[model samples]
Target: MELLQLQYFQVVARLEHMTEAARSLHVTQSSLSKTIQRLEEDLGVPLFDRRGRSLRLNTFGRTFLMRVNKALFELEQGRQEICDLSSPDRGSVELAVNTAGTLPAILKKFRGTQPFVHFHVQMLKVEEMHALLERGEVDFCLSSPPIRGDEIECQVMLLDSILVAVPITHPLCDKRSTTIAELKDETFVGLKRGYPTRDITDRICKSEGFVPKHVYEGDEPARLRALVEAEIGIAFVLESSTWGFREGKMKCIQIEQHDFVREIGLSWHKSRYLSKAAMAFRQIATDYFNS
Candidate 1:
């Protein structure tokens, strides 16, 4: 099959609607349908199942989509390498970060050191960052501990300890330090289920033999702090993340008992070759964190 056919199939598989896919590809619906039909006929397998106006990829299509996506990404990377070779100093780096705390220090240092290099940092979920890395949409990512998966290469950038954030007016505000057990009955604000910090929060609470009485679920640290400042609930966050807080509204107490330390790091696909610009930024990141 032609590369165009694979591109069309990939888009259709992603959108799951021939009409929408056609619109996105700037082609007529009939033409897109015929192209896919020809592709399926040539392969002797149905790629998609039509259900009313919607479409879904069949088992074969799912596998085919993965391969096609990888091929497209590699092709794009090859083109980028050529472009980067021609203008290494002017090339851009796309970096994704899941948390704001670890970003500021690195970004500050990067800006001071590599003022000529362009950076695009997308604040994504940890899982979303991993997906973008796999798709070759981003060159690298910064995320928390327990960096699983065989395809990714991770390096620790910094060590952070968990802290408890409470409204200044709250009773717990008087405490210099606290245990997870002390906060068991307190109304808690937490990151949403899949966040790296949420996993740590859950593990600490579970170890203490109590579940958090969660009142709010915020995915961003800033938003979680807002909820905590409103006296809605107490939140557990990395100590570095408390930099933006004002002393009047919130107080951050160290969680001495939980051993809730996390290592923030940079990750990229091990199989992918780093672009010159990405390599420069990675080195800059390494030095920035180490310093």
Candidate 2:
């Protein structure tokens, strides 16, 4: 029933190991166990199925945990609201990003207007970003192929075309555009699976009846060109990425056969409280991308 008891239970439910949970909470194992026991007694039902030192949430615990998470999130929001009210000019904007291509420009523009407002940016997989959005953990998410749900509000900022990048010496460099089918036999340097560009390009290749044979698989978009330039392999890159490689060592060809444009969007959970600082970032990011 106590706030302390609920907090302890949340940690235990997540870790599922009493000793590990207690260590994380900086409390003794016996004390943490006693707290959970008291909470279960108060509710008149066992929350977790226990075996030795391991714990697993039963049906009742799973249902209660959802409510507990919401309660704690609201309490944390209340605290942030109070702080935001006191200093409207200074606060932090927490953001989860799916693609980092446009971040430099967006953050540079945002900081120009609200220099005092700090940013906490995390580059996450699409699923991880969705999880954070549902939990009200992030102020906003910059995503590709836009996150869609009844509880979320999303606005497309840009329609970025995906292009094929090749070294100047490559045979395909003579053409201004190429089809996905044409690239089937060519070795590619690609972003890892979780990346939006990688996912989109994979589907494009799948639709064309063959997987892209990757000479190298990496997480960094910046290295895609370098890999291609060294004849490691050609790559699928965003149109915006072409700007950095304009010296002529690499050529970015259009995908003429498929309209391979990815929609970049700004998304936020509708139920979460939007602080003034976070709102400012949203407006600035929207304007920057639109312009």
* TM-score per candidate, chains pooled: 0.80, 0.91
Task: Note each model's CA RMSD in angstroms.
Answer: 3.4, 2.1
Q: Look at candidate 2 and give me any clashing residue pairs.
A: none
Which regions of candidate 1 fall more than 4 Å away from where they truly are?
Answer: 23-28, 108-116, 145-147, 166-176, 189-195, 214-220, 223-233, 243-251
> Candidate 2: which stretches are off by over 4 Å?
244-247
Worst 10 residues of 2 by lDDT: 240-249
Candidate 2 residue lDDT tens string, 1-291: 899998898889877899999999999999998999999999999998988867899998999999998998898799789879999999889999977878898899889889999899998877888888887889899998787688889999999999998899999999989988788899999988877888898988898899999878988888887888898999988887776456568888898878798889999988788889899898888888877
Quantify all predictions' global Cα lDDT against the true fold: 0.82, 0.88
Angstrom error at residue 118, model 2 = 3.2
Model 2 Cα shift for residue 53 (angstroms) = 3.1
Q: Give the best candidate by TM-score.
A: 2
Q: Mind giving the per-residue lDDT tens digits that candidate 1 earns over 1-291?
A: 888999899889989998899999999999999999999998999998888988989999998888998899889888778878887776778888866665677777777766777889897877778777776677788877625467888888888788888899988889999887788799988888877778888887887888888978865667887788888988888876765556879899988655788778888877666777788778887886787
